[model samples]
Target: MELIEVADAVQLGVERMGVGPPVLLIGGLGMPSQIWELSGLTAALVDAGFSVIAYNTRGVAPSTATEPPYSVDKLASDAEHLLEACGITEALVVGYSLGCYTAQCLVRRRPDMVTGAVFLAGLQPSPIGALVGQMELDLIGRLGEIPAQVRVFEQLMTTLSPAMLQDPETVSIWRQLLADGDSLWSDRKGLHGQLAASFEWIMNEEPHPEHLAQISAPVLVLAFEHDVFFPPRTSRETAQQIPNSQFKQIDGAAHGGLFSNETNVVETIAQFCADQRHRLDGGGSRYASP
Candidate 1:
């Protein structure tokens, strides 16, 4: 991993591999670039002949945190700068969960830089989601840091499919893996910063109509069948807001499908990107450079 300065004193750690059409991967809230590798998506994408660029977002280790009160728009700006620094004039962008909100902001803010986008475990504005963010911030303010075990339990309970939870072996494995958190999520302050930003964005800044419709790039919103946070209905609604966006639901998968249903998610993403490249070659839409 190399640290690239994206802004004044703000360096984002990035990993690049393979060579073909460039695909920028923006991870979820407090997610480090390494999760892509852990999910097997990075290697799969590399083997499938695409240049993969993944990075640890600001506030994550090796990346300058700067101050907090960050917004999704700010995260989107970081992504834009990262791409520009890499000399990628345009590329396919992929965002997972909170990363989906960032990707949406990026597509709208800088259409020229994004050829197409994929929102994995997509996000749509929800009163409930906003409320949850507020609740998290409130709890942090009142109780200090939430215990790691409690956080892990909440994560597993919310993200795993009901079927997966029912499987004792699967549940046990996940329990162990999550209990031993990775370096990427070790910074409590960074995670709280992200939580604050999410609360602010969802409550105040998320576009209602005109903003999403302004996005001109072809988009694919991939939804998981059992995602409590972003169910198919929510993902489809988000897709409806964006022009020319496609929504596909993955059966038997939950919010954590990116890992649990790795093969399907990887195949779907690879196919969508490949199709976009083909479209660009055929003098298709405005996906080509101006």
Candidate 2:
């Protein structure tokens, strides 16, 4: 693991393995890259003859939190800086959840540096509006108390996906992450600033749908059949928006099930990448869109 300083003195820690076409992995919101370590997905990808790079997002473990405010655009810029630091001019970007938003912003801002993208359990921009609507600001106000906040966050994660509650490893990692973020969460000023940035980025900014037509690079939109946060329809809509995109729904999986069910996830991605490579080598597109 190595730390690369990006914009705003955010020290982003990245881990790289294998040697081949670069595949940049971006984690979901509030979770550190270490979750990937526990899932063994990183190792599996590395063993599949592809170079893999996974990094901690800003405010996550091993990555320095930006001062008070940070937007998706800022996070995207941080990714760009991290890629440059790693000497990666172009790569196949893979993002999960909030990281998917960052990926969209990166491709929009710097299309030249992206070869292709894979969005896992991704959502449309308006999804955040639904999330904020469901959230009770009054409850968020009381979240200033660390213990209560931690409990709430734990319950929230469990409610989002019961699999989280059943998986001890996932629960443990989540608790540890919450503990790490305790200070930031307790500081009302900081928490409010971060929430404001998140809300602004999701609601105010145009959805990636507008730029989907502009994305020339092939995209694979992967979703779990039982994702609580993002339904299968979300993935279908995302694929439909992109001119050159395909969608696949993995059965018997929840939001985080892609990690738990690593074999299927890895195999699907490998096949997609292999097909794309073959197409580039004069093989016509053979995979049908979902």
List, residue by residue over 1-290, the lDDT tens digit for candidate 1. Answer: 89998888788988988877788999887777888998888887788767789998888887777666677888899999988888777788999988888888888788887889998885675566676677677777888666677768877886688888999998899988777653564366667777777787777747567888888889998998877777788778878988888989998887789887533888888888887875433232222111
Candidate 2 global lDDT: 0.67
- 106-180 per-residue lDDT for model 2 (tens digits): 899888777788887765544644465236333455664335564456434632356556778876775665555
Candidate 1 lDDT trough over 10 residues, lowest sum = 281-290
Stretches > 4 Å off in candidate 2? 125-129, 132-197, 205-208, 277-290
Top candidate (TM-score): 1
Clashing pairs in 2: none
Question: Which predicted model would earn the best lDDT?
Answer: 1
Number of clashes in every candidate structure?
0, 0
Which residue pairs clash in candidate 1?
none
